[model samples]
Target: MALSTSNRAAPSSYLSLGEVAAELGITDRTVRNYVARGVLPAHRIKGSRLIRVRRSDVDALLQPVPVTDGGDAA
Candidate 1:
């Protein structure tokens, strides 16, 4: 049977804390820190302590910063 569009879950990439830490070249604890600071969105399984971070949320943090014009330069 074909699944209904309304019943489909949104497409999203999720990574374990260790996986995210490896991808970012940081420690797992650091990933946890980001989650604690609300810098990254995360979720934990019911009755489990494991945390998962959304890949899109991590990508948002990697966005390039815009450069400013020299108009305000002394």
Candidate 2:
């Protein structure tokens, strides 16, 4: 007997907290906490937690912080 393959295609990118953490070089718990704290948005698929952070968001987070002099420059 031969098995049949479905025509469905796999998702391009759906990540769990662990996967997101690995990608961002952070701890899994940090990802979860960020989700909980509403810093990062996440969605639930079926019954598992799925976090889908865009590359832009990651880049924004990785951007260098701006430095301010003690004088009022406005």
Candidate 3:
């Protein structure tokens, strides 16, 4: 049996909790809270305290703000 490898690769990257926090402009503790609350997903390294989150997952967290008419008279 032989393993096969593909020449193509996806643009996926993993980020640490601190990195995720920095990207979101929030505290690392807050990032941990989000993970704990299931708002964000995280993966724990085997036999280590390190945790990793996919960059795409972090991007998914971002949402556009809705604009309101603010009662403007036309």
Scored by lDDT, the top model is 3
Over 1-74, each residue of candidate 2 has an lDDT whose tens digit, in order, gives 11122233324444556777887899988887876776666555433333455445455666789987889767
Winner by lDDT between candidate 2 and candidate 1: 1
Candidate 1 displacement at residue 26 in angstroms: 0.8
- What tens digits encode model 3's per-residue C-alpha lDDT throughout 1-74? 11122333323487888999999999999998988888888777555666777798899899666888889688
Residue lDDT tens for model 1, 13-49: 7677888899899998888788777777777644555
Query: Candidate 2: global Cα-lDDT?
Result: 0.58
Which candidate model has the greater lDDT, 1 or 3?
3
Q: Which ranges in model 3 have alpha carbons more than 4 Å from their true place?
A: 1-12, 65-74
TM-score winner, 1 or 3: 1
Displacement of residue 22 (Cα, Å) in model 2 is 1.4
Worst 10 residues of 1 by lDDT: 1-10
Per-candidate TM vs. native?
Answer: 0.70, 0.54, 0.68
Best by TM-score: 1
Which residue pairs clash within candidate 2?
none
lDDT of model 3, residue 15: 81
Off by over 4 Å in 2: 1-16, 43-49, 72-74
